[model samples]
Target: MDQTTAIIDLDLPGPRISRHVYGHFAEHLGRCIYGGFFVGEDSDVPNERGIRTDVVEALRALSIPNLRWPGGCFADDYHWRDGIGPRDQRPRMVNSHWGDVVEDNSFGTHEFMDLCELLGTDAYISGNVGSGSVAEMSEWIEYLTRADDSPMADLRRRNGRDEPWKVPFFGIGNEAWGCGGNLRVEQFASLARQYSTYVRNHAGNEVYRIAAGASDADLHWTEVLMQSFDALDRAEEADAPAGPFQAVSLHYYTMTGPWADKGSATEFSEDEWYLALERAGYMDQLLTRHGQVMDRYDPHRRVGLVVDEWGTWWNVEPGTNPGFLYQQNTLRDALVASVHLDAFHRHAERVVMANIAQTVNVLQAMLLTDPESGALVRTPSYHVFEMNTGHHDADSLDVHLQGVPTRTGEKSELPLVSASASTRGGTALVSLTNLDAQAGRTVVLDLRGRDVVGHSARVLSAPGLATHNTPEAPDAVAPVTLDAVRPHDRGLEVTLPAHSYVTVSLTLA
Candidate 1:
């Protein structure tokens, strides 16, 4: 059988790999917090201070660098005061955006921070700028990060914790043009400025302030935001101008068509698979076009692009509330993950951080949890993260790939393989995805810059596109060590099975 040839030239290196690129998001919606990740301290699910012990072990395996919490749209509506203090004193509110279920303020600021501490990850706090006042937003920051004797800090101490926690990443709002506040570009920017100004920095914790960015292909939002920041810069010239933000965020997802009919997660046709992969590949175009618009204003690239919410969204599980985006993770979802990751690695200079939507029991989640059974299963997407761990903080290697034939259909065309590579220390990591639904690809992975001494590889796939794991069969779809990893003249070669994702860690001399 003749195999399609694809060349990977590792000679070209790009930006430094950001560890934050592999970040995850855990929103205050669905079972993500209540029953999925945090089951309360009293639960018998084997918890460490209310955080699921099993999820802790799983996330730690991937070296999860950062976690964004509290909201997608929930952040805009979240009032910090209502979530802090004694649990009995806290007020309950409806999670208006995700399921109108009354959200008991049980798992609040302290619990989330505790989870972050347990997992050893940086916390990305999405603050409220929409319905929240400047004082409310400012006080929330003061309570979390200030070690001084201020009222907010004092209140935090009285609640429980005496020491302040570090707030590394903070977003001023979320989806401002829509669920966040439905504000115009100018209005959102104005409020972002005012809210951010009141957010004080203390205890030597330099927060990476993020501006609530566009929802999908809204490139105009990015342009207006930078313009708004530029105007802010000019106004602050006399007062030692502080940079506007560390990054501006963007949100996108892969679903079967529009919101009205986001087809089933498990049930899909071949054409739907093509549509899904096509949607995933468009992340590249989104980054490229959005980056170009960002460059027009930020010529020096002082601020990077943060894809805060992204994943394959689908119709919620049967018998579940439609608003709770709980969908099963399948082999198809793993391919979607690999496709977006390749796009992120290629545009590392501009795309600094990306977080997959709702980390558990939600859209394209990494884990499916059952609080009743105390059953936890790591999803196929979870294996992809562990496989690509080599790319965290690794120097980006611009691996040029070609010669793989395209899978042409009436609606979409995807190359048989999509790949990227990075190196840290003396080892290089190459990730390749065989997006083809039927045929396997034999790729001659070329490591151009150095000679390899040895290597190891692993592949994550299943018998079918929809193959997935349930609590009863947790290991149904997991990674396997590939014996086909072989040394070529100056590089390596590997064969990828149909609908598979492979990662190679090469030892370079």
Candidate 2:
């Protein structure tokens, strides 16, 4: 059997992988907001201000950095004022984007901020630029952050919140070219600049304004957004004042099939598995290519690349709402998550933040909540995030693959081994994913420039690729201690089983 090797240079650490890179996205779509995260203050399920307690507890385990809210397509059409004031007095609207269900405006700004507080995560608020006015977007920011005797601030106090809430990240718009407004890249660039100008910082609460960017291979959208920035446009803590925007957003989803026919989430063939992984690996290419374009404009890497929407998008489950985008999470989804995270680490210098699409009961979600049964099940993807919490705020280490094996796909080939490493304080965490489905492989960690005194490892795998968790069998695919680790003179050796994700924590000297 061929052996895979990953060479890690302990002394040559890369950029600080921002904890924000591990961010999550929650949109007011499908069960994500109503049944998933917010079970209502009156729900039988335990909740804190309508925020699901179990869901918050599950996400808190990952120490989720930031959460993008009220978005995807909903951000463009949503009016913040309708969601504020009294819950009963709040207006009702139709969520045309997802399931076409009537939105009671129950889960609005206050509820979302409360949810963020409960989870100890930052808020990434996406404003409505498509259907709303510049004044509306401006007032929303002011209402959330203004603390002094201002009109918006006074209104906020009357509404309930006496003190202002810090909005760390604010999005000017969502996908301006598509569901956002169907505007051209050039048109959206102008609108983004206009809309972001009003998203101001109030009372020292600095907001990181992120403009809507591209998806997949739309490099032109990135170029236009980058070119729109001038010397005055910069993030907080820069030499100049916070300008038009601090970052440009990107949206990507891994699907083996096409848009009209996204492949099944649970039932899939071997070819589909390899194809799905290969698609997830494409995030690296998107980052590198977009970074090249961004570098031409801002060589200092001032503007960050925020992938706010990402994850596996499969067809909806049988008999479910087609527009709801509800799907099951499996071991394959876990591998896909690991692959994209590894890519984010590889481009840590440019990719500052990322949020997997839909936090609960949506695409590639962390928890699946069945309110009917009152059961909250953690998906396999959740375990991967929980195990990788150590990588947050750590310095990314350079990982070089040598003698890596490959699996032949129908049209392309994929590397059987994928890995990334990081160091925080004195401990280094190495993440490895073996994509092989039927065979296990031996991998050697060639640690250089550091003395490893002690090491521990954990592995996540299941008997089959389609293995998933339900309320009845929540532990079907979960992380377990890998006893096959051995200490070598160089570093540590791990025996990775088929279709598994492993993390080895090394105490460095």
Candidate 3:
């Protein structure tokens, strides 16, 4: 095959993509909270209000834009009243679904807002509509946001926090089609309307009300929500006075093979690994299909697409509780994240916000926590997030590349190379990932319309495919800075190693 040169024209301007979509989720599952973010004030790890300072600092370093709190399935059963006032006074409940463990409600409303403040990210509070009532949801919103001296605000002051927390994002319910309530689209639509009515926008802050959407590729769910929004809009025009649903959500997890035999974390055949990659690469199609559904009713594109939950779901670590949902991160996982982000950039017009499943000690977490030792470790996914932070809120640029696909088993032709470029703060940043495991590819990045002067590159690769970060060897998978990167007259040429992810930032002249 001849070396094909594809020209990428960045002359046309594109919409400024919102960085909020690059958000994260943190649930009450396993060590994600008790041992992950919270190590208790008495623990050896330095902590404030039982939250590890080390974990906070690590997440802050990543420049996390937003975080979702409490439950995947747990959100439905969570009640705001259980986790308030004095810590000792708080009630403890059984986590029936996740390990059947007991939840002390220690990390409640105030704790979450405090964590968001510490990390400097917006808080996306998913309201409890499955088990709770509209009055309960409304009161929770009022308690956190209302500045007036109402009953909820007074209760908040009694709890220790006097000032109202600035919560800009809200989700009516999580996975309403599944764990949330098992409600169909039509059923959830009425429920969404009732729940959203009580969520008052306090302090004049614009709260982005995101309705519960499809689990994955459920076109009927999307259509129903869109139609509901349309009907509500028309009714409002006819003097009904309704607030618009700011965004619709979609959740997807990349899992290959049977759910029972999901392979191993650190050990996998090349074919199985490639199958995983092929699954992760499906984000493009997922977004495309969902976006098509939204375009039908929302042609003007008023509503934003929020992919609130997404990541790779592999088998849990050996001997660990299955409900912990813990797994190892490899270079393959990093490539999956890269391709997903690239796809998000391609559809930035509609796909506005997304959050990786859970931040730590869960599926494809960015950080890992050790409750016994109070130690915090970074995962391969963490490095990918750090490297790609430059693309957040930057204008997505057009890029074209022609390369053969990476194939495995019956499934062939996965995009061997995936990339996205954006200009921010007078610097053009290009992130490229070579997903092929066996071969390295030299990518020639053409900057015809955009000026390129000096450049530097950072790469994250492993010695082998099975390489990962263990508790003892936390720094096993980290990024290395390439010192020598010369900018040619035409563009930049960089050699990408096999199964590697590289990020290059060029100072535009």
Candidate whose lDDT is highest? 2
| Global lDDT of model 3 | 0.82
TM-score of every model versus the real structure: 0.96, 0.98, 0.95
* RMSD of each candidate relative to the true structure: 2.4, 1.8, 2.6
lDDT of 3 by residue, 430-476 (tens): 88887778887777776777666578899999988878887798878
Candidate 2 per-residue C-alpha lDDT over 318-371 given as tens digits, one digit per residue, 9 for 90 to 100: 988898889999999999999999999999998989999879999999999985
Task: Record all residue pairs in model 3 with backbone atoms less than 3 Å apart, i.e. clashing.
Answer: 21-353, 21-354
Please state the error at residue 161 of candidate 2 in Å.
0.8
Q: What are the per-model numbers of colliding residue pairs?
A: 0, 0, 2
- 257 in model 2: Cα distance from truth in Å? 0.9
Show the lowest summed lDDT stretch of 10 residues, model 1.
232-241
Worst 10 residues of 2 by lDDT: 232-241
Q: Write the per-residue lDDT of candidate 1 for residues 393-477, one digit (tens) a residue.
A: 8888876665777867545677768888888878889899988888888888766657677788889989988989998888889
Give the winner by TM-score: 2
Model 3 spans with C-alpha error above 4 angstroms: 1-6, 231-242, 404-412, 483-489
